[model samples]
Target: MKKLTSWALIRQNLSRKPVRTGILAVIVFLFSFTLYCGTVIGQGLSQGTRTTAERLGADALFVPYGYDAKVQSSLLRGEPSSFYMDRRFSEEVRQEKGVEKVTAQLFIATLKASCCTLPVQLIGIDPETDFVVRPWMASAIDRPMRDDEVVVGSKIVGQVGDTLTLFGKELTIAARLEPTGMGFDTSVFLEIDRARRLLLASELGPRLNLPAGLDRNAFVSSTLIKAAPATDIKELVNRISQKYAAAYNLDFVVVAGMITDMAAKLSFFSRCIHVFSGVLWVLGALVMALVFSALIRERKKEFAVLRIIGASRSALGRIVMREALLVSLSGAFAGVAAAMLVTTLFNAYIGAVLDAPSLEPGPLYRLAAAAGALLLGLMTGPLACLPAMRKLGRIDAYIIMREEL
Candidate 1:
């Protein structure tokens, strides 16, 4: 019976001050917006970081000796870079246990005349098992590489049947691949033989004739190894390095380790985001407290009348808290809906600007936001009602009525 009476009294008080209630509702809306923004940004960062790590598929990467910095910069920072490794290391690594597959790739820098003289990275890989890197690279133009043909990245902006002149040699663009937001987006891929031919030609200052039945491509630039399990891969890499210590001077690089480091850095940034969002939530709660306190002060006379009419101190406090809660819930729902709509609408443009893939908000994110807003709202209500509760408790109802009459 008391709870029913208190609810009825809350409705009466709210109806008496529609404008105050509306103002409190607006404050709650603003608080919810702040929380939504903070949560969405943190989620986007985490998604972007994970996407980047997944795209670089390999438990371990093997690069040339003394080129760790160069390889890391090129792969992680999207810089145009190159390195070299002897072909002997590829054979030695293949013989090691736990090695599933070994592929050699060559990365060379070329000045393409068609793309406005931009320096582009040219990568050469065997198409047979290169699906690891070019998994999504469909033939958007002529076809996959034939002899003396090259495929360009989607960003190259060359149409089908266009010739790209690189190092004074004209090669037909066989195909173009979809953009991956990495250095590969601006690169060109060709068969290993063609890449070696181009590199040798550039070095010799002329098209060098290959000796009959002899391929001059004695060494590959780098080796990519696919191994089973993290521990096994690490052990295999170590064994290969130890066995060929004197015979091969090539460096064995672990792409997984680099990616793990990147993940750690990303996690650190996500934590920072969480802390920032927490601060915003606190600020919103404080604002709400002030707004509710002001509203309670304005309704003091009404509260006193209720107290005189047999309303207990607790009942009066419940009335104020109920109003605050109603405002917060309505406002929070509205704000979260708005934030989700806005994020969905501009997600494509935002992803482009951030140089990352589009982010889809997960269920966990929405649930957390809803629960957080409610708790904050509930906490703010009591904080706001404290002053009103104290004033009503100390008031002399007989004197208030006598003075008013």
Candidate 2:
């Protein structure tokens, strides 16, 4: 003897045809899920490119000829690679007229490093001369890095003070840096002397055999240069390339050019996702309209009976709308939750696949995205039911009952 209110009736109605209700809910779920994932992914990539550019903090980079791609992959995708250039190359670059600061780093791509399960890049830096990485490290460690002490990137497994074995050498972790959304996150940083020691160690060093006449103590992987104030970056790049390209067989990588290229690719990727989402939105709306129209027809007798039993035209309309609202709300919550879970679990893999390591968005951005997706989801149901509600308003109870017979 419970009162049969509109909401109560709607609950009963949906419970009776569970399959149909599930179908409608699934349609909305797909739309919302796709929208939320696409939005987050696009924003993450754009932000990642900006973060990477800031992290580089240099005008241009110099690497051995034919190894530019290797350096790019190592920086952007966290791919472990080993290449070396003469240490004197950095000294020469430091003396250039337009060069404000110059620093060199040595690279060793290690397999089965104790810091991570996957292969990670090992970097060697001179704390005194390093302008690129030293600033970031300063916040993590107050004192100078010792020969046996190493600094780790954010993604490295162990905490500060933990010992990690590198090339059979046990090194202490002195500090851990904040995430940079670049290959550096999986890299380990050490002093130049320690790096050279590992490279010269007889037992495990010969596997990456050094080229003849290339002294381990005098080899570096890349020369990072910061241009002087108001310096013409293009002219500087051209001058350096001309001087070193043939003489030293070096490649010049302009940081700005790298970012611009990444941005263009990200723009195209974002557009594709936006267009696909738009198409899905339109298709979802159309399908909802058709489904609801048929549902209203099938329930004509049910509405007519309610009207005879003291239900107003408006009340009957409310019944249909309330059902749609319930389904939409449920679908929206479920879809967004699924998207969040998937993204969280596979964030690193997604970045690797996209080749753009992006910083995770703040909570406010996530809240806004969820709100937008839910709003769209909520709107779809009510708008689709509008025509059905109108149809219900014009139903003649007596005529409908007669047709049912």
Candidate 3:
């Protein structure tokens, strides 16, 4: 009987002011939408960062002695830098016990001849053996680089077949690879031989003067190694560093450290996003609390009448809370649905705009958002009723009747 009475009372309150109820519903919908959109965006950014990291498959990276800072700057912030290492070190590293595969790359910092506005990171790799990063890249573009051909990053404005003049020589763009949201997206990749020729053509080329007939391809900027599963990756890195230090008489920096550092930076950004989302959620709760509190105050007399008719204070409080919970849950649900729909519709466009991988919100994210909303609603319900409940407690049946007279 109490349950039925509560339901009837709820229906009566809702019907009494249909216009006000409709307005409150709209407010709830808007609040929910804000919460849902913030959560989806935060989840998308976190996923995108992790995906980029996973795609870069190198267990450890080997670079020149002092170029560690340069390498990290390039990877994280798209800064232009160069490094150099002897090709002999590549061969020796491959001969190590736990080394599975070793690949060397030459990176050149050069300006485009046609449009020399910004610097470009030109990468030179042996097409035959370079399979670690974006293994499917070769197949995706079909034709491989020849003597004077190059593959451009997806963000490269030039199209396939267009001639891009670097260091005064023109090279054809054979293909374009997908964007990785890293410095690579702004880079151009070509055969080691071609890149060497372009580097030597510059005025600063004399600084790196080579032997009269030495093969330019015999030297590289860095080597990337994939160690055996049984091998400790860090141990392998330390061993390789020592070996390269003794053999080449040059500094050897680990690329894996740079990757780990990048991961840490990404994690920091994720936390910042989480905090911002949390703040927005709190603001939404506060708004709901104010709206509910005002509604309760206006319904004081109605609550008093219920109290007069043998309704327990606990029962009146439950009804008030039930109304708040219903409104909050409905709003939250509507907001989340709208956010998902918006995310789905614009995900591709957002990925392109950000020049990062597409954002993917997993199942865990949805479950957490739902749970958070429920807890928030429950907490806000009681707080919103405090003032009205106090007023109801003080009202006597005779006093209310006298006021009514």
Candidate 4:
């Protein structure tokens, strides 16, 4: 006896019900698309949070009490802001016990086409005392920045010696720093002397009620501090707070943390995406199961006819399973392709509108997501056919055959 060929039967059965097969495939495609997108977003957010925090490279940020939120928004979103504290405040923090290093920074906001464009956080640092920005600049350009020259962020559009108008002053770009998916990516670091001169000539100088002499060393926007090893970070913050409490008004808020809040928020958001993905998966599974169940029910007569022709029940079952697989495979391919197109569009254009610190998940993560979607889509085929397989085997074959006759 010639045994039935499941492969040939699988093709014939699917081609016979093109509409049904197509609908089933569309369902699987939807499942794959959502899973792929969700995986990428969740993974990207997680990586961005960590990279943004590490790029800060500080144990704590000390700023004016109410400016804490603005500083965060400034660093993360590049929102324009100009806040200042008396210079003596910086000197006092340095004397605090267990404070290993302290650096003062001045943030000057300017027009996008001008210096300090939110993309270029116009900042001034004393090269001799700067422990933070120098390391990053050194790696990108072999030579140290000279006066009247500035180091730009990786994303800033320009080449060395290209001039930028910062605070009405055109300064030469000395070097560009490597991008870290943080505020630094757009930051423009200048020597303290130049940054101070530029700030004084800008509108900020008049707005801050400058002294008659207009001393640059008199005010700074904020301070970045690092604690000595083994020193309790929280304790150091407290000590700094106590020292300032009696002498100066409590206008400064000391942030003894890195990207804690941002990271936590992103983590929660990623979990929500995962939950949404799970719900989508459940819906996809139910759709696949119901459609296949109804499809098998309609094919009862077809199975009965095969039985009369000497086709075994198991062979008939294989045909249905194979058809399910082809349908699912088709959907998965379509879904993954759609997901790739959507992601590419976002990275190329839509992402800039967000104007927030972000990191692209590496290739390894993206590949894993695609592979997972493929495997999951393949599994649904057999799982959806379970009930149909049993019914095809146990159904009253004689009744189906009699009805067909």
Residue pairs clashing in model 4 are 65-252, 65-253
Q: On lDDT, who's better, 1 or 3?
A: 3
Per-model CA lDDT versus the true structure: 0.64, 0.85, 0.66, 0.72
Model 4, 1-405: lDDT tens digits are 856577777878788988878888887887888788777765665565576666666677777656777777667655566766655676778888898888888877665655433445777776776777776667877876777788887768788889987766788988877766566666778876677777777776666564333245567777788788998988887777777844543343334343666566666766776787678677877877888788778878878888888889888887888888888898888888888778656742322344345655677877888889877877777778888788888867788787766
Order of quality (lDDT): 2, 4, 3, 1
What shift in Å separates residue 359 of candidate 1 from its native position after superposition?
7.4
Q: Which residue pairs in candidate 3 collide?
A: 33-335, 61-255, 65-251
Model 2 Cα shift for residue 6 (angstroms): 2.1
List residue ranges in candidate 2 displaced over 4 A: 1-3, 211-213
lDDT of predicted model 2: 0.85
Worst 10 residues of 4 by lDDT: 347-356
Clashing pairs in 1: 61-253, 61-255
Task: Assess the local accuracy of residue 236 in candidate 3 as a C-alpha lDDT between 0 and 100.
Answer: 82
Candidate with better TM-score, 1 vs 4: 4
Q: How many backbone clashes does candidate 2 have?
A: 0
Return the TM-score for candidate 1, rounded to 2 decimals: 0.61
**Mind giving the per-residue lDDT tens digits that candidate 3 earns over 1-405?**
456667677777866877765655555555455555556655665565565556556677677667766765555334567767677777778889898888888888875445236788888877766855437465656666677778877657788899888877778888887656566666788887678777876776777754343345576776778878788888888777776775564554455565555456546655665675566556655665666667766766777787778888788778877776665566556656676687768754554454444454766886677566445534444555466566556657567667777
| Model 2 per-residue lDDT tens digits across residues 5-50 | 7788899999999998898898889888888888887777787888
Q: Show where candidate 1 strays beyond 4 Å.
A: 1-55, 110-119, 128-131, 134-143, 147-149, 152-165, 168-182, 200-216, 228-231, 295-405
Q: Candidate 1: deviation at residue 134, Å?
A: 4.2
The C-alpha TM-scores of every prediction are: 0.61, 0.95, 0.65, 0.83
